[model samples]
Target: MYTVSVMEDFIAQHYLTVPDPGPEGEVHSHHYEAELTLSGPELDEYDYLVDIETVEEVLAVVRARYEDALLNEQSKFAGHNPSVEHFAHVVWDLAADELDTDHLSTLTVTIWEDDDTWAAYEESV
Candidate 1:
């Protein structure tokens, strides 16, 4: 299978809402990195899994939507903790909605809250 990926980094703030969250319960900023991957067994006529420019365009909008924003206040995070795992799923939904997935078999969104901590959500297209 072939895969194409686009990534961007942004700063967003959120506070864990779960009980006994400790310091994480306080609003904090994380330098977040988001990566979106498209995969399929066959490439398009243009010899690409998906158009890189198109992916970049979608990623730009995704970046702008979250960059330097308060995740807790975002509608997508409404009633949900802005954890890395949830962030990945949210990003996946956003990107999937904007991209053409007819030719892809899988779409994956990975979110890195920091250098070492990260979470991912993958779906079949």
Candidate 2:
């Protein structure tokens, strides 16, 4: 299988509702780094798994949408905590809508909340 990945970073604020709760429920910010990966069994006619330009475009869109925003207020988070894991899935969902998934058979999103911690989500086509 062939795979291609794109990466981007943004800053956002969110709060967690579980674990210690309390002040953690208060909004905090993170310098978020997101990585999107797509994999397929074969390359497209252009000899690439997918267009790098398209991936960059999608990542840009995502960065613009979330950068400097309060993620907990977004409808996408709704009732769930805006944890790194949840953020990864949200990134995957956003990319899925913007990407041409016909050729790619797998999609994975990784979100890094800090230098030491990250989470990911994956889907099969």
Candidate 3:
């Protein structure tokens, strides 16, 4: 399948909600990077898996909502953990909410908490 990916970076703060989160339970910030990938067996007449610019526009909007904010305070995470895994899934949902995916077979969202650590969420669109 052909794949097209777009990436962006933002900053956000969060504190884990677990009973024994320890250091993670404390508020902290991350220079986060989110990459969204769209893949499909067939491309449009233009031969592009998807428009990179369009994808980026969607990401920009989504990322802006979380920029410099605390994830725990967002209504989206009211009953959820603000971990990398959940964050990636939330981003994927945000992107999919606006982007047309009828031509795509799969979507994957990767969130980098840091250069050395990351989490990804993938599923059929």
TM-scores for all candidates: the values are 0.97, 0.94, 0.97
> lDDT for each of the candidates?
0.92, 0.92, 0.92
lDDT of candidate 3 at residue 67, scale 0 to 100: 94
- Prediction 2 TM-score vs. true: 0.94
Cα shift from native, residue 9, model 3 (Å): 0.2
* Candidate 1 lDDT over residue span 1-125, tens digit each: 99888888889899999989999999999999899989999988888889989998888887899998999999999999889999999999998899999999999999999999999999999
Q: Residue 118 error for model 1, in Å? A: 0.6
- In candidate 1, position 22 carries an lDDT of 97
Regions of candidate 1 where Cα sits further than 4 Å from its true position: none
Highest TM-score model number: 1
Give the per-residue Cα lDDT of candidate 2 at 84: 90
